[model samples]
Target: MFLAIRELAHAKIRYALIGLIIVLIASLIFIISGLAKGLSADNASAIQNMKADYILMDTDAELEMTKSFISRTDLDNVLQMDGIEQANSLSVRMMNASVNGSDQNEDVALFVTDGDSMLLPSVRDGSPITQEDEAIVDASLQREGIEIGDRLVFGEESELTVVGFTDSQRYSHTPVVFVDGGGRETINAIAISVDESRADEIRNAVGNSFDMVTKDEALKGIPSYSQEQASLNMMIVFLFVITAFVLAAFFYVITLQKRDQFGVLKALGAKTTYLAQNLVGQVVLISIMCIGIAMGLTLGIAELLPEEMPFLLTADEMVQTSILILIVSIIGAFLSLIQIVKIDPIEAIEGAGK
Candidate 1:
């Protein structure tokens, strides 16, 4: 460790170049990861907010909430089953909304459910929506100049008064709006709260006509959720591989360039293990410093992002990425030790003189 620190301080230019590479790669990983998570949250926050443990959809509908139609009879059947706590209809629809009489329209995801149902998001600014013509909206609507008491028009006759604003619960990248669908009891799906063990029982009771999937499984049913997640995951995998190879190649070259120096150290009674430790320490020190700088940059950039942009950097994610990078870098650095261990001090000194 002492030798490694001395070498790094004396060879500032060389170490700085490697550190810069680490910073760039680490920053790319952080930014891409944030994007992946943000996109997922934007796609499913509405469903994620549901208190229900399971989401029931028509099996024939292939898990798509938009395609599932749960009639009053199906809903009542599920509610009657043993171990069931509560069940309610939830209708999901996408529609254009605008303040009444305004020509400008913004796309919004509409969640129509029983007005008194507990499925409604906890209001942050005003009271929960209870009437046929009232609605609760995600805070994202505020970006478009919407506020409490503003009446948003839906279709030809339904005009909803914005009774409240709630924390973000966007679906498919659009803000969510909760409205009372009075006299329209038919629904896209049913949300149920039940014990984990009873989920199978409920599935049996509902028979082949219904599909009961945990909330997490239901997320894949949303359009593009799987594709988006898969693409970003692949990018991360590729980045990790690329980073590993790059570090290995860089350290291998550095070791080759310093062959005579390592040979001299070995001749002076330095153990192969000691030389290996020095190399590992240098890699770790460089990686840690670069990762730290990258984290600071990522956080600084996150604060500047627009609220509508779904970029999040959770602590767990940061720690996981940092640990993975360090592990891979250490492995790459170790690859260079092969040449170090094979060095014959006498041969190296003779070759250097020639």
Candidate 2:
């Protein structure tokens, strides 16, 4: 890598541009990953925030909660099981929300559940939305400048009062608003707290009959969850692959430019294996720098956005994604190693434009 570093230092502009591209590309990978994760979390947060071990959804419905429906009968059968402590129903809907008549309306995901449960978490403002005129909004939504006691229009037609707020219970990429059960009786699904053995039994008995799932599986029930997640993930995977090819191609070109240097080193008794390893090592160094800058940039950008932005970065996921990008970036450079070992000293020195 000494040779590669020396070459990069001497041609800093060219190398820096490549590194910048790598940085931008890696940042994009991470930003999209953050967005994907944020979207997943936003869409699934209500379910994720559930204090339950299991969530039951409509069997005929795919994995999305938006498409699911549960009956009072469905509710009763589960309650009858031993070790199954309790269950609560939820209704989900997407609605248009506007504050103070500004062009600032946003889509809010409606979480229709009894507000009295611990599963709903605590309030950030006003009070728990225990009544029809009362509703608890997520803090992320409240940060949009609407506040406690302010009103938000729901659906294509009218509005509902913002009685209180909570940071918990986000669903399908929108902040959650908890309302009374009467708001939407065709409740979307149910959250169930169960013993491990009971979960298995319930899963086997009623699940096989009515078609239900745990929380994770219920995410697939969202109308757009599976398709959108799969599409975005495919793009991320392809982008990573393209990044690897581009890095390898850049390094391969760099190696060719340094063929005479490699010949000289070889002529001085350096092993081809050592020289190849050095090239791979250089790629690793550049990849690390690139990934680091990408993360810094993501943090910087997230801060610059308005508070209303749905962008969120989970610490563990961000760390995991960064490592994965670096690993792939290094793999990209390793592909260049093949070119490093193929250089012929005699041919390179003979100057057939080697």
Each prediction's RMSD to truth:
1.8, 3.8
Residue 313 C-alpha lDDT in model 2: 80
Candidate 1 lDDT tens digits, 69-165: 8788777777788988888789999999878659868799999888767688899999987688899999989889998998888778778899999
Tell me, by lDDT, which candidate is best: 1
Instruction: Provide TM-scores for the models.
Output: 0.94, 0.82
Specify the poorest-scoring 10-residue window by lDDT in model 1: 180-189
Q: List the candidate 1 regions with Cα displacement exceeding 4 Å.
A: none
| Model 2: worst 10 consecutive residues (lDDT sum) | 179-188
Question: What TM-score would you give candidate 1 relative to the actual structure?
Answer: 0.94
In terms of lDDT, model 2 sits at 0.75
For model 2, residues 1-354, the per-residue Cα lDDT tens digits are 776687668888877888898898888888788777777777777777677777777776665666777777767777788877877777778877777556788788876676565466677667776667567888887567778877777545666788877775677777777776643446777777888865667778776645556667777776687788898799899989988888878887887888788877777888988887777677777888888888899999888967655577877877888788778877877756776677777777777453
